[model samples]
Target chain A: MNEYTFPIVFGVFIGVVTRLYLLKTDYRQYPTYLHGKIIHIALGFIAAGLGTIAVPAIMEKEFAAITFLALAASQFRDVRNMERNTLNELDQYELVPRGKPYIEGIAIVFEGRNYLVIFASFVSTLAYLVWNIWAGVIASIIGLLVARKFMSGSRLKDIVDIEYVEPHFEGAGLYVDNIYIMNIGLPARQKEILRYGMGFILKPKNFNARSTIANLGQRQAILHDISTALGVYRDSGTPALVPLAKRDLDDGRVGIFILPQEKDIEKAKTIIGNVPTLENAIRMPTKSEANKKGRKLR
Target chain B: MTHEKLILAVITTNSNKIAGGAPIFTCDTREEMESVATNLEAILDGIAHSLSDELLIIVKH
Candidate 1:
């Protein structure tokens, strides 16, 4: 019945729509089940309600209500924990586990997207209350653009050059390029590995990229992503048929060895190229003070 | 008390080379050693790594 009622409704609607837009289940296949989608949608609705009420609360001089935003922050943090716990539990049985870093990265994204929904709601509500419905629509559009910008991080192809290399063995040792992967004792197992395995070498583009790709977590993420995209040719009690990534000590190149069911090199390369560079795994060594000084000296 | 990486068993053609803590199965021929190693690998769920032609150790990771 109040003037703020329509604005609040509009804000919440925009926020939920924004959340729906962002909650896409791509090749990652996360939140793919109906129950998972329902859980996220419920959380998104709560975030929208919190965001929408803040505008009127501010206008009514109920500044105390603003403190609820702090409550929302903590609430979203729990969403991150929930995601982490669920993913960690499921990771145990995976053919190729997503690793800690990839799980953490996914959890962080779920929390961050909630905040983006809040921002979209707040902006649109403020616009609707102050100006008009058209202005609120425009504001929500701008909000969505900002959210899209924040959603995507750098991909593997941005920082590395990927080249396919057929895995070869020297005696018992299996190698991808010059990188030593592992040793296979059994001739039959070695033959199986050679038949099913595919290898790729990732060369870092710069000094910063060198350290990033060298991270064990980042390397594991690459392996997990590739395994998930293309089916893994591994089973329980078959440890010999596992995928591995080894780094070259001399150069900052990484060698990837995978046992995928599908032997499509082009498809696998595209999947690797699209793998998101984990935010936690990114190391900006060149930006460091000591490194900057050394660069100046040279 | 718990070992993350431990040698589960040893399959070798040469008995003189290894005198160790883990269970050892000495075979007469290279083919016999390989078969034993493969069986132990399946039973113990560990990887069989050959140190030499005569020695193969199954280690759990």
Candidate 2:
């Protein structure tokens, strides 16, 4: 049995591991500080290089070699520090632009100093790899994980210009949708209640002023869903529930007048045809003994 | 006020030539919703525009 057989196996494993690391994780997109750790790497390589000549000059050949070895070891230690510093900095959001880390990760393996450390560690170790080799793999996995956490699943800009284009129609008909998404689970005691902006528009099919007012009152109870769907304005800290942002009408239509309940009714009067008050008005959901899932307008 | 009034406003946009009669009334208050039918006076200026055949009726009541 070869004593070195186990070591050889371990060596191959480390080599494969280090090579695999270079293959993955593009570090080019990482922030300047992260990639800037090139300073530590450069210093490490410079020391490694200078040690080759300087250590031989300082003492006997064997002693010089040992000194160079020690220097090389310290340089590796510094490289590990730099790697770790880079990892720590990259842990947060927007730490880097995004794509840089993905691009430069492979290049790290090709560098002469990292390559030297990777091979030597494999050659010398019977079992354990150099600490940074293990750390490098760990740091890479962590970086990848951290990067994914910062990346957004969807962009808000894509959903912005929402157009609900409908088929063209003539005569008088109406299309209405509420302002906000209904969240029923909301506790009533909470001051911030869900507001649904109600929307209603009229097309003059056969303009009968009298029947329209009477019928509108009758339909009040059913319009609870429409009212609840109205959107609330989040202006001046208080949410104003405004249903209609805009309106359009054809010629041949005439509005009677507006009947305002309060002072600010003028704003509303100008927007819709004058106000017409029905006998029964809209009311929110009342306090009930039973658990009420249904609406209040009814 | 404990009994705060719930209001509703409806706006209509129509072309000038097509619009006729009194302007409809819409309100900031839900209670005044029915008052609009009684008013025969065309409060709104007829939307007698230059070219468009659409009429507008901004109703608040």
A231-266 per-residue lDDT for model 1 (tens digits): 898888888888999999888899999999899999
Those runs of model 2 whose alpha carbons end farther than 4 Å from true positions after fitting are: A1-27, A30-41, A54-65, A94-112, A115-298, B1-61
| Candidate 2 per-residue lDDT over residues B1-61, each given as its tens digit | 5424222222223222333354434344322322331121123211111111122232332
In Å, residue A134's CA in model 1 sits off its true spot by 0.7
Q: Candidate 2's residue-wise lDDT over A1-298, tens digit each?
A: 4533444344444444333333333323222454454553444344334333332233333554445555556655655555545544453332111122322321232343444434433333422233424553454345334333432222211211112222111222212322221111112201222122223333333223223322333223112112222212323212211222222333222222111122133333233332222222222223343425444322
RMSD of 2: 24.2
Model 2, position A235, has a per-residue lDDT of 31
Candidate 2 backbone clash number: 92
The TM-score values for the models, in the order shown, are 0.98, 0.21
How far is A259's C-alpha from truth in model 2 (Å)?
51
Error of 1 at A70 (Å): 1.1
TM-score of chain B of 1: 0.95
